[model samples]
Target: MAHNEKLALLIVLPSLLAGCTSAQMNMLTGKRNKTYNDVNAPWVGSTEEQLISKWGPPKKSYTLESGAKIISYEDMWGPISAYHVCVEKFMIEKGIVTKWGISNCPTRIKGSLPKDTPIPQPTL
Candidate 1:
């Protein structure tokens, strides 16, 4: 191969492999999106009261400039080794949940990933 081609491959190969896709991340975190989505999909139209009833009062709540409300709940029972405590945030408009996001929330894996394990970040 030409020198420039080899250099390009060397740069692109690691870049492509370094970042984990959402699916891969879910697997590593022990969550299957299909099952999780099946269960959670209905929540999109649910009332805020229903959510508060099921989850109890959120750890944090706020209102946005657009008059939408946001509530956040944390799950401390998640896998403790590699992931941080799971945080769920929901956006409520007119008392209904419109959207949500979750981070670092994974089911309890039997073991933890090693601390300080090196992961290559993309060079951009």
Candidate 2:
């Protein structure tokens, strides 16, 4: 690769890594919050049954053709307050979780709803 290209990568890569680290720290410290579900509370390592017990039933649950379990939780953001959906894909193998992911998620979900405004009912 050209010298300029290599130099740019060296500068850009560290900046990108630093940005991600800061975001992660903010998330952990609650300095930055993600409005999906609850910023103070997020999905953690727990059994499917435990999750259900706490969050109540998910909006949608399905087994993929490959047998992955996908559970969707509906949340919202903004004044006109468009509906926002947060789906966590659980990778279960042999009845145990292998991994999970947040799909199509933004860096943050913001809302201006009243404190008394109930969480939107999931239309799943």
Candidate 3:
């Protein structure tokens, strides 16, 4: 093979490998896109300072009995496909997410739930 061809292959091979590794890293890290609005991105690594820099102040703030700081924020899920959305709660302890829970807001439908719609009873 020509010397030029060998050098070209060497460069292209490393570039291709690097691209594949980066793609895999992005997928594993859940960085589907670069945006402050991606709800799927992991929130545990955030510090109070970094969170404020990115998303500003929380809508509400509270402290748990264990002395953990809980900052509440409003996150919209979908205006696109499914058109269903809800606000989620993130539990941050010592600047790390310990747990998360979702609110049971009504799902958007063609029309609002009927006035006569019975509330489902909770089951054990």
Candidate 4:
């Protein structure tokens, strides 16, 4: 790599890790909020049953001809005006989780959304 590129990376990497992430920090837990990567990394070699036990039932589960199964978990919370959705998929081979990924999850970076919208929060 060029000297300029290395300097640029050195300057940019810290800022990105400091706050550019979409993940929030949990007040109660004092831990970084769970992102798909953070939550699923440990489950890479875990069994399907073990995953299910921790995460409860998946939203959907199906198998491919290759004998690898995929388990998906989706969660959307908050009101219609401001909600978040993420569908996390895990690949299970021989009943053990081998790989996992998010098919289509949309997230607003911090400060991307307006704090004070003209529309008020609706009460049910």
- Which lDDT values do the candidates have, in the order given? 0.67, 0.53, 0.54, 0.67
Clash count (model 3, backbone only): 0
TM-scores vs. true structure, each candidate: 0.52, 0.41, 0.39, 0.55
User: Residue by residue across 12-52, what tens digits does model 1's lDDT show?
Assistant: 98787669765566566765334222334456789999999
| Candidate structures ordered by TM-score, highest first | 4, 1, 2, 3
Report clash pairs, candidate 1: none
Candidate 1 local Cα displacement, residue 25, angstroms: 21
Instruction: Please name the candidate that would achieve the greatest TM-score relative to the true structure.
Output: 4
Model 2, TM vs. native: 0.41
- Model 4 lDDT tens row, 28-71: 22433333454556688899999999999999999899999988
Between which residue pairs do clashes occur in model 4? none
- Cα error, residue 44 of model 3, in Å, equals 1.9
Q: State residue 102's C-alpha deviation in candidate 1, in Å.
A: 0.5
Local lDDT at 46 for model 1: 96
Error of 4 at 67 (Å): 1.1
